[model samples]
Target: MTRHEETGAALLSVLLLVAVMAVIAATALDRLTLATRIAGSAATVDQGRAYAFAAEQIALRRVGELVRRDPAKLTLAGDWLGRDFTLPLPGGTGRARLADANNCFNLNSLAAETAPGRLSQRSGAIAQFGELMVLLGIDRGEALGIAGAAADWIDSDGNDGPLGAEDGVYRSMQTSYLPANRKMADPSELRAVRGVTPKIYARLRPWICVLPVADPVRLNVNTLAPEQAPLIAMLMPGQIAIGDARAALAARPAGGYGSSVRFWEASSLARLDPGDIAEQTGVTSRWLALTVNVTMGDGFLTAESLIDANGGAPAAGQAAPAIVRRDWGESD
Candidate 1:
């Protein structure tokens, strides 16, 4: 109740106020620190995505360059971000790589229809298509039907293909599955065809492509995969053995057979009947499908490149592009 007692009470009040201020300040500091960390993490994720996008652009440019040159000279491992990698595409942060188109079936070739024996190359293409189906574990008859359906899809007319699914057959299905009257706008449309199951389509997706609706089918030997070598060989007359083409491939570079002409230049190709080599080499009437698989950290971008023996770049652009397909996974 005296002056000293009152002064003491005032000091206690000030001390309590200071303690409250200190506690509030500490809480605010903790929140600010957490907010900064969250912002930093978000920035890192966005940066990784941007790096992946840049890698895709680089891959497209490389594919365009290959098509400009010989499709055979393309390599995924050369000087990308100052290091080497494989063709299926380099897998790492801030990097993307591409795979050559020669490894896949040229979907455009499915349109050709000259009564069985007339166009030998065309017939060979049909057989090669069957071979591709076989590699995917499909039966020969089913392969033939699927290929024939594709033919019906591309040809201008409405006739049924030899295996059905032509206008008549497809139009008649009670369930109503059939070949399209025009070339496919997208490869996924193949699912609508009679024999192509989801499983079959998935197996064929990597090895086959339907691009640009306008592109033709020209098999690029330089881009052909080992499993697809036989199809390329079959496109030549005299039915070159799959075993021989595979052997010839072993001697070539890991990417592919190199130039198509170089593929013919190999002794193994020469071993085929002279007439067969003459028939296969230098035929560029068909279109070739070039797939550029660009993989960046945490992302995958695919570019479908169509090459003319003459030359040209893909129509796809550098922007927020629509994905034909994409997948993601944790890094090792």
Candidate 2:
């Protein structure tokens, strides 16, 4: 071949080699940049989680201290569980808010219905929840349906009652799912039941909680102020108006009722059935919910926990109180 042609061929080969090298360099640079970003994000998330776990320990210890001091004073009116504080962490921040779990109605109580169709009985939580909905201005039939459906999801039997939706009804749906046939796993599960629309669930969410146990929703009157009296009014909705409930709560003695007897005597709730009142009311709190939020750089973490301080404190100079239950809660 001619000298010029050979030179041209060598130059072409060098140019092709350079192009290939450039492509590989560009690809490696992109991958390295992506890996760096991923590592940074992971570090931030790890820090946030560490902060959340630390906050949880603090909350549990606070509850333990309260139980040790005086169980009766464990109500929301006290300073222990009501304190809201922020912690300054290294290159981040974390905060926690404490709320009285008993302040809300226990949705698990609906699963405790003994008589399937006797939903109107004042002794059952189904009846009380139904009445609460009615008092909230919900249609009577819809309220009854919501309560019955809540129970139907729990009861072992597959029978579809007047207001309940059983497996047959659920299976026939377009989504084609089956009934839980057990206690609800979360309050959000209520939206899966019949007649429990998003709107209704939203209205009820603020006032209801899914306690770990299948027990009735008991109101701790001492922790409730006039603003929170609607929970007390929900007990006998047909008889008590929201204003009257507030009045009774406002009339509570300073520092709150000292005991169940004092609570009954100080409020019109004394007029309720002795048995029903005794079964569904208390003067102190057992459950506490804690929400902790942690932020580290671009990462954020939130955790919720339900703490059951059922084990009362020991006599003075004894060991610390025991926690009956502690479980994680759904995300906010």
Candidate 3:
């Protein structure tokens, strides 16, 4: 071969080798970048989870202290109930809020018994919820439909509620899902029940809650505020008007109404015909809702928990606050 041909061939081979090395180098760099991102993402998520846990612990401590300090003085107006906590985390920030959950209408109140989904023959909660709808000015038929459907969803019995549908109605839908046949896990579940339009649910959302405890919960009269007057009106039915409810609510002592008797005596409720008023309302709070929001890097995580102040049955020689429920959710 000619000398020029030999040299050119050698040059071409070297060029090809360099190109291959460059390609390999580029791929390795790309993989390294991707792996670094994955590791960083994983670390951020873990940090978020840790922040959430810390927030829960803080809430538990605060709530436990409040409940233990003075059971009688616990009320919705307590500074701790509506306060917000912002914590600085290593890589992000965590925020938490504790709210008075017991003062609201518990959707689980509609359930008759604590066992999954058994309808009660005598639970007044369903009637109270129906009355709430009436006061909200919802169409009577639609309101009844929502209450009845909610009852069927929670009750083990196949009995139909007035204007409510049975499993048959749910099964006929295009999606074809069965009735929960259990207590609602969240107030959002109401949206799934028939006749609960978004608008209706929105109106009711502020006043209602779905507690993990299936037993009926009495409204906290001491914590009840003027904005919550509608609930009181419903509680007393014909006996208490909304203004009277607010009047009674405002008259409560700073610490609280102190007891059902004190609550009855301080406001217009003083004229409640004098019998079993505690059955409908009380000054004590049983449950509180805590929410934690953590922002780590570009991602977000939110956790909600229900703290039972009544200190649920604990093992012998132990005093512990009940964390009734914990749920991961998104900000609305």
Candidate 4:
């Protein structure tokens, strides 16, 4: 218990202090390294997003040129309908594809535009949708029920169709959510409607779209692929079979029909009664979608832009086609 003992205890204390300081320094260094890594990842994501946006602009410009070059007809003559291309960016790369977005059945068509900002159940469109479901292998009664439910969901009324549900019915469900009673902004909303099982949704996803308008479906016949022939068949239910529709599309001229009349005149489509469908078919597309994917370092970015080309010819100084909507994070 003398000076030696005191000195030994002091030495032990100094070693313990050194070990504690070393642990603290190590922990601080680890946290700094982690923060620096997180910041780098964020910067990389931002760069990728920037590249994706640039690619979208380029796609829009190309679409503008295409529409201006030929306002009357937009054909697959140059393989532009589903064109895939790539762009090189500094320290990254961008991939993009342009597609005719109006070739599918517009789900909003279930609701007819009676007047500006007014909507009602569109019986004809509902029938067509049901026909489409039947063509996709769903039972006819089930298809009609699903179509009625979809119409009720968007029709701006509380009265439900015979096979559909309204707010009262929805309120009685286990989950308890009311009908939107408005046009859907995305086709995914169909999942919320009654009778639309996940399996049914998967079957319908590829052939349906939710355009931003309640107008009846207007399909560009020239852009319809063989796989999309069911859309044509649905327009003329009980007349043109799906196989015949595909045959009609297969027989389409490489340069595309000069007009909807020529399209209907095709021998393969002669069985289709053009009743009101002629007004719904066209050679020009009104909507196009651009999907861009960017890869930067360890990050990835995806974006989709919906362009409405209903604007008159850009060559005439009318404002070029407008980008009505843009979505980031995922492409549908």
TM-scores for every predicted model:
0.57, 0.85, 0.84, 0.91
* Shift of residue 322 alpha carbon in model 3, Å: 2.8
Give a tens-digit lDDT track for model 1, residues 81-140. Answer: 213333433343333334433345567566543543221124445566766787557877
Clashing pairs in 2: none
Across 1-332, the per-residue lDDT of candidate 3 in tens digits comes to 99999999999999999999999999999999999999988887777878888888888887778766765557654577667888878767788998878787788777767444455533466667777887888876777678878877777777776666777888888977777777787888888888788899998888888887676657777666778888877765456778887888888777677678777776587777646536767766777788898998798888888887765743211355667788887623
RMSD of 2: 4.1
- Name the runs in model 2 displaced over 4 angstroms: 1-16, 77-83, 113-123, 267-274, 311-332
User: Candidate 2: lDDT of 100?
Assistant: 80
Give the least accurate 10-residue stretch of model 3, judged by summed lDDT. Answer: 313-322
Candidate 3 residue spans exceeding 4 A from truth: 1-35, 76-78, 114-117, 121-123, 274-277, 314-318
> For each candidate, C-alpha RMSD in Å?
10.2, 4.1, 3.6, 2.4
lDDT of each: 0.54, 0.72, 0.76, 0.85
- Backbone clash count for every predicted candidate, in the order shown: 11, 0, 0, 0
Which model, 3 or 4, shows the larger TM-score?
Answer: 4
Estimate, for each residue in 1-332, the C-alpha lDDT of model 4 and write its tens digit.
Answer: 99999999999999999999999999999999999999999998888878877887787788778777788888887677677798988988888998888888888999887877677998889999999999999999989999999999998879988688899888988999998988898888999999999999999998898888887888887888988988988987778888888887888898888888888888888756696789888888888988888888778888888888764443322667777888887733
lDDT: which candidate is best?
4
Q: How big is the positional error of residue 192 in model 3, measured in Å on the Cα after superposition? A: 1.3
Provide the global lDDT of candidate 4 against the true structure.
0.85
